[model samples]
Target: MEDRDWLILKTIYEEKNMSKAAQVLHVSQPALTYRLQQLETEFNTKIVHRSNKGVEFTGQGEYLAKYAVDMLNKLRMTKEIVESMENKVQGTLRLGVSRNFARYNLPPLLSNFLTKYPDIKFHLITGFSSEITDLVYKEEFHIGIIRGNNNWKEQKLLLAQEPVCIVSKSEIDSNSLPALPRIHYETEPSLQSVINNWWEENFTQPPFITMRVDRIDTCKEMVKNGLGYAIVPKACLTEDDILYQINLTTRDQKEILRDTWVIYRNSSLELTMIRAFIDFIKSIKQEGV
Candidate 1:
């Protein structure tokens, strides 16, 4: 059936009368009746039960009406998105981000992005790098900002690779502390394995973990409270007085560390807005920052 048929069905469902539905639609009663007849022919089911007082949907019509509403809503959204993309105008972008990037980096960039695309809306979700990457791979998110190197074979833009440092309270003597309590994160499997291997190679005794966490922000907080010490990307740090980095006389040459990346489906590389954002990220040299 045509779109006009759904509109007629919707109007009839709302107005509950042939004359009123036609009046509201600014169409003749006979035209509305013909449209409904065509839909009923298409579906091979009765859709309306007419009474002297008004009209109501039959069981089949009720079901079709519900589907019509949903289809219409989706159609409108699709039209808006397509038109906006074509016109270089506005649209909604669903984003999946690692929890750390969502907390540390997205604030200013989002602020600027919103200013530029005022009609655009964002749906944001935060999780681990792997979790966000899975969503991107599944096409659940149009774009993703995730921590650690991407191994998904998708194209990615490196956002920032700030210095990764160990943080702890002043009370924890960096030089003399015996088997310091290191905070651990559960998100990055590759990085976690690397950290474990680095710890094993560098020290005869392994540093004990005071606590394990799912998010780096919490790990930072735990370190600040002297609950433990954590190694995290330096972009998470502010020049504020609340947190400090641990001093190390000797560095482990084998440690692997870095920050997050912006990734999208390989097919999306041709989209203008996506390319624009990638260029903006590189122009800022976010990796160097």
Candidate 2:
């Protein structure tokens, strides 16, 4: 089938509703229906079945959608490689970045990188480090910027390391932390495990968790209001936050540092845009916590 037909099937598969797929494709519903009918007729199979709930893909439809995804990816990769052959570094750069790094570091990093290579276009997806790593492994991203120690077996560069600290409205004794009211926030499982293990090693008593929140910033606000204390990475705190922050250390006295890494398959460096961006990443000097 043609690229247009492939895209049609893919979009319908993603959107799951005829009307939603049509809107995304920027085509009329009737036209979309006609196109799908033509595709099904050419294949001589029932591709998708529509019911009152939504559209459901048949076995053939599922196979076609998977084929469409692979073909689209191959075509996109070919375009990137061809665009990179020129002297000008201009091509689409797909990236998957961790949430904290995307929030604190990526904007300025991308701004400067774009200034140097004005023709380069960026497609960035921000998520948990674990999710980013999975996307990278699936070849959905040219590069991934992630946090903690992700087990990426290919090219990996340590971007920065920031201290993990406890913040509160007022200074509290380090030994008193377990007895203090703790503001708990959800974080990636890897990092959460690290924090939990550290707590277990350092204290005999459990933390007196007073409240639970979904985000680090929400935990910070709770701390600012003198509600409780939170343990967060240095990236979450600012100089003007007006809070007391105590850096954590290992039992042997080394600071507990949270690491950020840039990960990619080595083959990606063959592209001019990817190569240039990696070189640029190497040159930047990130200030420490």
Candidate 3:
């Protein structure tokens, strides 16, 4: 019912125990318990079920938790907006990025943003595109830059397009399909299925299978060592000397060209910081850099 009660509920959800939540909130245990009891009495239902180990949210608690999070986010955004009007842009910005972008794309963006706003702190979470998308929807991230897929929401920007490349060692002759290793990235099903379909259409038969890994860096490393031929984004390849590109003509070779996007929810755009960030991205493009 009150902000303090919601805060207590959030803390309990995080800490999972009354004593721990009280300690985290810098309040007496009895006071925290009383507040939670008051909330339960006001709602006429048990919000949380206490146990020896920790607390578990009841059905009512779960429903209220969602409302609490939405309320807290709105409150925080309101505070941030008011503060920004006073010429201060200082708050935490959570970002969700794929493992691919974390390596290839994040450095420059992070460097420039941090240099420009030294006071603003950042928390970067890296996972696959599917995981990042889920996080973005859950409000875990203010914005996410992810690889474009049909399943993603419509609100996204075409940031950059990097072609899919097949790389192998120079020593291997291209006259005949060598019995070399074949490396595949163990990414989300959407992209992985696309890769499989493209590989089948492009190659006469599957090449010798050596490894399947999650990260593009591993694929790149294996390719450099002549472990196998790998299909990956051109962005991952930094060295021009060790690896040789084996251009392929697949049915969806045109579609293999991956376009990166910046995605955010409609509600997130209402926040000044989020809007400024999107505007900054637009400004960067306008500068042609």
The candidate scoring highest on lDDT is 2
lDDT of 1 by residue, 194-265 (tens): 556555655767677778888777777787788877866677787663766652222544335565788888
Q: lDDT for each of the candidates?
A: 0.73, 0.89, 0.75
Q: What is the lDDT of candidate 3?
A: 0.75
For candidate 2, the per-residue lDDT at 66 reads 85
Q: Candidate 2: deviation at residue 113, Å?
A: 1.2
Clashing pairs in 1: none
Query: Candidate 2 clashing pairs?
Result: none
Model 2: per-residue lDDT, tens digit, 37-132? 999999999999999888999999999998998888888888888888885799889999999789877898999999999999999899999999
**Per-candidate count of clashing residue pairs (backbone under 3 Å):** 0, 0, 0
Look at candidate 1 and tell me the lDDT of residue 192.
66
Model 3, span 192-229: residue lDDT tens: 66567765665677667778887777777877787778
Worst 10 residues of 2 by lDDT: 280-289
Using TM-score as the measure, name the better of candidate 1 and candidate 2: 2
Report the error of model 1 at residue 40, Å.
20
